[model samples]
Each structure stands twice: as C-alpha cells, then as structure tokens.
Target: MIKEKAKKKWDLTRKMLEITDDEYNGVTQEDANLRFIKTKLQIAVYYLRMLDEHNCEYEVPWNKEQFKWLLRKPAGDTKKQKAKDWCHQCCLIRDKACASWSYEEATA
Candidate 1:
C-alpha cells in the first residue's frame, strides 16, 4: 500500500513537471528550458522532502539542481514570502492523509 501511494505521488510530481514545462514561455527557448529544468528540480525536492518525512526508502539523490533551486530567491519580497509559506504548508501536511483519500482515512 505504501508503494502504491508512493507511485501515485511520483506520478503527480511528473504531471506537475509536464504542466510547468508546457506553461513556460520566456525571452528565449534557452531561458524557458532552464526554467523548466529548475521547476522539475524543485518538484523533485518537494517529493524528496515528503518521502523523507514518511521514512520512505527511495533512490532519489541530492544534487546541484536541488541546491540551486534552494538558493534562488524570488525577485519580490511578497513572492518570496508566498513561496516560504507554501513550503511550510507542505511540511505541515506531510503526515496528513490526502483529501482524495477514502472516507475512512479522510474522516480520521
């Protein structure tokens, strides 16, 4: 069951990458390419953090991509604060059951 849940989370992560890639349109294709790559790295970091909190055994490794993503600060202070808040929310919900879970888990 844990493996199945993990697979679904991974699939959702990949879908997010696809959505972001499709949404990317920058000054140059190279710029969009880099943004897309960085977004994927960010998603990977998000997923890894989730897995870590769950004590899940997975092969995803720490790399420079994740490091660069962490180092990047949004241009505007509001944007930076929003990003920080979002990460905090993700952390808060790590142990909680998904809203889409069956009623038993959802109600528990």
Candidate 2:
C-alpha cells in the first residue's frame, strides 16, 4: 500500500512538471516556485525508484561516498545552491520513508 501511494505521487508530480514551450516562456514567479517543487518531487521519485529496485532495502549509507557528489555546489548561482539544499532535504525525507516501508514489508 505504501509503495502504491508513492507510485501515485510520482505519477502526479511527473504530470505536473510537464510544461510546454509556451508555458515555459510565460512562467511567472509562482511558476518558478512550482518548478522548484517539481525538482524536489523528482528527487523523491528517484529515491522511491531506487528503493523499489532493491526491494526497499537499498542501503544509501553504504554508498555515502558515491552519493556525496550530489551535495557538491555548482560553480555559480545561489539559486542552484538553494535547489540543491531542497533536493537534499527531499532525499532525507524519502530515505526515512523508504526505511519505514522496508520495516513494514519485513514484518508483513
């Protein structure tokens, strides 16, 4: 059930992020905020995919060195840095959710 809910959330987020060229050209500040949200959702969906691929037992901590590359700040743009922070937080949330789901599955 938790997996199904995650899948549904991923699908909805993907749909929400699908904007056409015209829509992108007309983006307002609110649209930019939505894009930021979409970015976070995309990261969370990736975590969900990784968890599902490994049967919810994906060991992120074991691969910390490899994943640390994700936290590296880009050469410029504070906005990008902010986005990275948001993505990191999203990852943490998904990681906790993945662990909880794994425990639930193990006991079932």
Candidate 3:
C-alpha cells in the first residue's frame, strides 16, 4: 500500500522531470524538491524532516533537490508554515502507528 503511493508520487514527479534512482535515494526530505522522490524509504525520510522543520517553526524556507541536496527558499515562504505544520501532524500519526505496530516493524 505504502509502496504504491510512493510509486505514484515518483511517477508523477518524473512525468515532468527526470531523476536517477541512486540520486533519488540519497536526498533527505529537507530538499526543496523532496516531494519529487517516489521511493518509500526516501519519501518517508523526506516527510519526517519536513515534520521536524515544522515542529520547530522555522522562518526560512529550506527546499532542495534530492540528489545534490541543493536548496532554494520556498516561494513567499507562506506555505512553508502550513506544510511544516501538516508534516508535523503527519509525523505524530506515523510515530504513533509505528509505536503501536512494534510487532510488524520488529520483524522487518
């Protein structure tokens, strides 16, 4: 289920742009274009970092391209606040689920 979501995202991101898998694998969510990556593990990290930045309530934008980690400040820096907030909320959900599903994670 999670993998399908990632593949869909990756396919969309790649539809208009091109990315190599290795480069895709290397970036953290801190990258401005982090949303562009389509892999489960990498995307998970990207969202987690977005949550952290949001939880800390940043004033600056920190957007990046996945492979090089090259970044640009988010435009208007307006959505940054909202994205950060949402990401944080998502993090809480993910964390809670992970904690409750220790049996599955432990085995993996």
TM-scores across all candidates?
0.36, 0.41, 0.34
**What global local distance difference test value does model 1 have?**
0.48
lDDT of each: 0.48, 0.51, 0.40
Pairs clashing in candidate 2? none
After the best TM-score superposition of candidate 2, give how far the Cα of residue 51 lies from its true spot, in angstroms.
0.9
List all candidate RMSDs to the true structure: 12.7, 10.8, 11.0
Residue 44 error for model 3, in Å?
A: 6.9
Q: Write the per-residue lDDT of candidate 1 for residues 46-79, one digit (tens) a residue.
A: 6555665455454544344644453343323433
Local error of candidate 3 at residue 54 (angstroms): 24
Q: Per-residue lDDT of 5-94 in model 2, one digit per residue for the tens?
A: 656645854564465464456556545554554465467557755565445543333233423333232313444454466567657756
Candidate that would win on lDDT: 2
How displaced is residue 25 in candidate 1, in Å?
Answer: 7.4
lDDT for 43 in candidate 3 is 40
Residue 5 Cα positional deviation in candidate 2, in Å, after optimal superposition? 14
Report backbone clashes per prediction. Answer: 0, 0, 4
